[model samples]
Target: MPLRQTIARYFSDHAETNDSHTDPLLQTHYYKITADKGVTILESLFRNDPLYDIHASSSDRGEISATITERKKAFIVATVTMVKPLQTAIDFSVTTESFLRFDLGFSHKVIQRLYAHTDKELPLVKNIEQQPAHR
Candidate 1:
């Protein structure tokens, strides 16, 4: 099963509480890349894609915020942190503007798509196996 489906199932099985304060789901994924490169790639992706509207970005700070309008408006904030010379962490926070408080795994789908796009755009370091998420 897809990660998003798995997460949704887990939440459903556990009877996870949904509160107004926590309506926006936050997800973090680590990628193998420098912070600078990560920010550049994200900027390019967001700027080039018609689906995303860039709200704010600071390459120096390694952060990008954008908004996407599908059935609902989704606000996305992505941050890149350098953990090592070539290891970086990417965090994505997605909030949807909806009448209902819960997203029913919409945020997870956004994160999964973003992560897949990043992986496709950026090539891995030569002879280095991709590492799993750190923490």
Candidate 2:
């Protein structure tokens, strides 16, 4: 299935079960993959800008890392650090909520954009083989 359809089906089937606190219209899944020691810093920074539309080209230097963990269920976490030339890095995480809250078309488009933005950082993930993973 296309990402859009898959996302919608996912939300329809799973949203309410996650929690009563999770709004079916605003349910969000969190992804947090990080380097061995960098998870803490990444988590802190990402929580600050969960929905920020950051671009990869905006940074001069940065790191990309991820980790997969099971919290009630399986989820992947992606950490991005966009560093400006000689400046402190702007780090954040993008989350894919289990529940579908937004329009499927919009959700798919946004994710596609983020996917392209992330692929630009391929040079950054040198040690590990890049996986064809998506939320």
Candidate 3:
């Protein structure tokens, strides 16, 4: 057997699983932006990354799904939801294609990088007014 296959067989949690693992690595993040803008920004981010290829997107639904092939073949899905006027939530799911059961924290690293990039790219608000007390 090949070196990679031998190592994978030794390190893998379960060998019975199929070649491509179906489990998803998931993470959710909150940001200060409207859902619409968040969708646009995320889409742009994914498209700009050479490692990723956007396969499906719905601006109206604030969802984007893409394939990433760098160190490993993976699928990424992101969803943006509006929690308040100035608050939004983004969720990411990464599924890697590998014989090994674990990705060695690769998915987490991807999420961290994405969050850092998004945070840096988002515009900062300069002013904010406190809400008035209810009468």
Candidate 4:
């Protein structure tokens, strides 16, 4: 990567999940569960965690918004979508609160840890149609 890009990544205060993200860590995660179940799993994750404060959640919309009130202050949104009866996709967007331009990849690390915990709660489903980038 170019120095500028590296610097931006290290300093960026925002991170989100994307299907074709250049960074594999930000790739969208699919799980083998229903959207409702996915939402329930995520809701419990925030409700049970002392560090997180769930601001709002909607099962109809399949969305959960929370704030990291401890350790590091940040806002996060988790989106759950049902692709099939038993297949669901979960995406997370995190933005850290700070006066500085970046948090040294703190937001990135938060997403990674969230994914790790989620992976344990629900089975991960690999992409069925992963296509290589054109050279």
What is candidate 1's lDDT per residue for 14-122, written digit by digit as tens?
A: 1121112122332344567889989999999898888899999998888899988657578888888887788676777777666666666666677768878986877
Residues 1-135 of candidate 4: C-alpha lDDT, one tens digit per residue: 568766877889998998888778889999999999999999999999999999999999999999999877999999999998788999999999989868898899999999999999999998776656569
Q: 42 in model 1: Cα distance from truth in Å? A: 0.5
For candidate 2, write residues 22-135 as lDDT tens digits.
223222222233332233444443344444422322122334333222232212223333223221212223343444443333433333343344334322332112246568
Which residue segments of model 2 deviate by more than 4 Å?
2-101, 124-135
lDDT of each: 0.68, 0.33, 0.67, 0.91
- How well does each candidate superpose onto the true structure, as a TM-score? 0.69, 0.26, 0.69, 0.91
C-alpha-based local distance difference test score of model 2: 0.33
In terms of lDDT, the poorest run of 10 residues in model 4 is 125-134
Candidate 1 collision pairs: none
Query: Residue 21: error of model 1 in Å?
Result: 19
Q: Give the per-residue lDDT of model 3 (tens digit) for 1-135.
A: 467755553454322211133222222455678999999998889888899999999988888988786877777777788777877777676666778666655655566677678769775332223236569
- Which candidate's TM-score is highest? 4
The alpha-carbon lDDT assigned to residue 44 of candidate 1 equals 91
Model 1 TM-score on a 0 to 1 scale: 0.69
Residue 119: error of model 3 in Å?
A: 1.3
